[model samples]
Target chain A: MSAAPILAAFRQAFAEAWAGGAGALLPLGFLGGTAVLVPLGIGSDTDTLSAVGPGIIWVSLALSSLVTLERIFQADVEDGTLDLWLQTGAPMAGIAAAKTLAHWLAAGLPLALASPLLALMFQAQASLELLVHLGLYALGGLAFFFWGGVGAALSATVRRGGLLISIIALPLYVPTAIFGALAMTGGIGSDGAPMLLAASTLFACAVAPYAMAAALRLAAD
Target chain B: MFAGQGEQAKPLPVTLLTAPLLTARDLAILRGERVLFRGVGLSLSPGEGIVLRGANGAGKTTLLRMLAGLTRPEAGDVARAAPHHWIGHKEGIKPQESPRGHLALWAQAWGSKANIPEILEKMALKRAADVPGRYLSAGQRRRTAFGRLLLEERPVWLLDEPYTALDASGKAMLDAVISSHLRSNGAIIASMHDIAGFPVTAEVTL
Candidate 1:
């Protein structure tokens, strides 16, 4: 039940995934394509990626998070390593917590940190404005891992459902995208509404772990 | 040269007790819409031994898993003492890991120090200690699995097809190990195709 063993397990899981080319290539490729193509799509005086940059960033973060789910149980399960994990005297809740934390660090944290460059490519206006958008993107990215955990757990037992995860996960991500989009483009209609959007992001983060754990137990069954 | 340390362990003899070490009443196993076994009743007390015999695909693995607490029964009672040692038929040892490391992991799980050299020497696995488990021959891998059983402290042992890759000497070692365990008054339920090694314990066939 302690945090240490679970954390250690998570680190080991994450490291193995990283060494094995853990998710991000597909999403990164898609984003890179959008970065190049979106500017071409908007041929008018209105810039391209700038107009669509935030949206693409949001989608890419979601995709990236989704891709990482493929690695959650693949290697361990294949190698019979998970037998030991499941047999350990520890509770599942702690295991879920550690897994989510590692997923966020490996998958979400880097995506968020790189959001500013994406924002700049879109020809965003001011540094402060770009920072706000990037900040919002970062929060949104962090929030996605919880959903990803749930998705990963849902797919844990299945052999090849990792790619199908977007179908299972995209619905839960709608609210975050909506609130995040509003926060990004200065679309807050009323006073204190932006704060509400930020609050929702935090709320998603809080609720993710429990839901993911439940999904994992169900998947395991 | 292997001496009294047998290849396949004898079901260690444990003190006889009224409380059964392993019990299942009306137990049933269903795997993926297939009923493996139904109304299986079994009980093994200390110093008792039973051989699980049936045709292939007769739910031997499923029943073993159910008994090991790795799988749940669909009906009836399947109860056991906590922390009993179980070795399935699949050579469940991790292939990429070294023999020594696998023993260490087994030790960790069963609460015993691996004493790797002693185990390797006893099992004729000393030469393969540093080799990956996958690289070993079938008999060698089975030997590796037997090495893990050496560290088992529990009174109840559930072994499935443990004779799979053993040689003449290896088979003798197994017989000796089972004898030693029986001598210690431990209870054993082993699913095996051959019954030449264990002579004293009562045999139950399903």
Candidate 2:
């Protein structure tokens, strides 16, 4: 397929992500709220807060990505856009990938950008290196959205699929989450952990689109 | 139109008129545990239209969906010569986007190179063009969905309840659109309870 349709789908999904004005900010708020509560709950011991800061951020990012998964394909399925796409002979996998990319850009990218400030609040010390590491870890956010998208597509037919999507997606997210958290703390020099994280992201990118397309087709049926 | 020089000139109109545009055979559909319809069949040629009439729960929508390839038949096959357009009961308009934006997005997705404004105007959606879809009334939303049929050119149209929520003007616009489409050798399969004013070539009662 040419880049035109894919770009159009991406733009549409991005616009939808920001529709109703507050939809785009929900994830960021969730991230910041989680960050704030973690320090308060764990007591403001600087060492303890810094020690667990990266892990909290990763968890928050995963949860926020999950929060937006239901909207990825459900709305389109409900509104007949998927049927129109199918009839037009557009490749469902390509459309799925484009929407996932849009979700990552609209929701995941913002959370990644905000990680540095949240990390500072947790007393992780706002170092340039830490910021770069958080950015690198952000790449895994795309994997989350793509893989979670598969689950969302699978449950598209279910009237209330939010919980089912979480159940199906969270287990699939374990490996990426583990590798990503490891990379963050183990630093750039850590032997193969960062590489493993990148590999997981690439693997999800490769496999999630086809899985999602199949699931969407089944849901339509 | 003239044929190539010294070549045996083929009559294009006769050839198009003879071939079937869409065909279905002995179709069966089961929703959940109950059978919706069985032994259903239909064939459509260019410039033809079929109206499907059945009481509620008689599977008119399911039959139309099967014919459009949106849903699979339980025990039959559907074949079509060209890509078709489908308009379901749902308007499918995003509440947040304006009618113009929604139509433009669909036009882009369908790879339509036509002028968007002209199509919207033809659908009588010019006044509500900039209004968000959620803000549009039922009739306006249905009109916006119907605008898609004009946005992209296709060989066949499958519409379910095309008259639902349409006022007299909206119904007139729909009739005009359907008439023009048939004039262009386009085929249509519409499921509707009331088929008055529709130029139907055949009828299928379930």
Candidate 3:
């Protein structure tokens, strides 16, 4: 009935994402670590790095977000916060959305901010256009969490749901990953690709919450 | 300090013998292939407490969850006049945060007016107020979970194995809290292997 509870949940979820110190840094570390390993494995050829840079960044972002997916609702389920929320008469969908938003802020935002530096490591020069691309990646990251969160919610009853989450969510991530990579490499001229990516993000934002909420409700049962 | 607002200020005797606050009829639950329990019925009015007794694997926890509306029964109905509070086996404390931090979040979420410090003191967790939850002992964690009952004023409380890890003092504190809750016309349905320490008005064995 009141917005206060939902807002408080959002804040608490965000704080929880950073409470252990390690949670906030984990995605960034995974992204950066993966980016660093790319160049060492591949040859130092500039053209090769540039050609694969966008793909690598997209892949790293998806993987990193997946890495943190287990935290979205598992901790809440374990500690009884989920039960409390269900009892409070707050909409489960709203709580799921708030947690997903917080997850994006804590995990996705940092990855977006650090993407350019990671891209530069792969010899992709920084530019204003790169900022726009990174912003899209960040936006797409929110969608990633929303979609992956459904899997996380469904697997809430399962202890150590990391692998199950990946199995359930990775397939759902294909479209976003494809469109995001296309927009990244196709540059500013590929307006359709970015537009489609944005649309997917918006669609996921609208739909994932209900699906996640239902999954969580089932898990609680 | 205890009589602040809402139902807390009302005397329990006035609401006694009123309409049932919670009712469950012919509740049956099947876990996997096994029917854990069946034909369980209960009616709880204000100032009443029900202690669910059963041996190990007797579905005490399942019955509590079903009553709390967390789980659905295969065949039966549970009707409640108000939203109930539930404290399951899980402490629900975030290991990374302090007790005060966790309590603050819960209080805000539940819109509780209870004083946090007083609750911490009541639970005898004042000394461990700033310690991360993971560091808390089993007894301390159980006490912290019980502290949630004071934070929110709910008419019904569904507690599963509430005295599992409580020490002598903690168990005594729980008794006192439950008594006060009953005094305020609040109802409790607790599932326990033994109901020796509780003042239960009714008993249901599954």
Best by TM-score: 2
TM-score of chain B of 1: 0.85
Cα-based lDDT at residue A219, candidate 1: 47
Candidate 2 Cα outliers beyond 4 Å, as residue runs:
A1-3, A187-189, B1-14
How far residue A94's Cα lies from its native spot in candidate 3, in Å, is 1.0
| DockQ of predictions, in order shown | 0.15, 0.41, 0.44
Worst ten in a row by lDDT for model 2 chain B: B1-10
Worst 10 residues of 1 chain B by lDDT: B1-10
Please provide, for model 3 over B139-170, each residue's C-alpha lDDT reduced to its tens digit, 9 standing for 90 to 100. 88888888888786777888998889998898
Tens-place lDDT per residue, model 2, B51-154, is 99999999999898888888889998998875677899877787787889988887677666658798788888899999987799988888888988876667
Worst lDDT 10-window in candidate 1 chain A: A1-10
User: What is the descending lDDT order?
Assistant: 3, 2, 1
Off by over 4 Å in 1: A1-8, A22-46, A74-79, A125-139, A189-221, B1-18, B31-34, B89-152, B164-188, B196-202
lDDT of 1 by residue, A1-221 (tens): 23434654675556544545644454455556666666676753446556677887787777767766766655555554554455445555566667677766766676776777777777776577767666777677766776766677777777887865667778878877877776666664634545766776677667766776566544433
Per-residue alpha-carbon lDDT of candidate 2 for residues A57-163, written as tens digits (9 for 90 to 100)? 88888888888878778898888777766665667788889988988888888888888888889887667877776666588888888888998999888878989
Calculate the i-RMS of every candidate, to one decimal place.
Answer: 8.7, 6.3, 4.5
- Give each candidate's fraction of reference contacts reproduced: 0.06, 0.51, 0.54
lDDT of 1 at A87: 47
Candidates 1 and 3: which is better by lDDT? 3
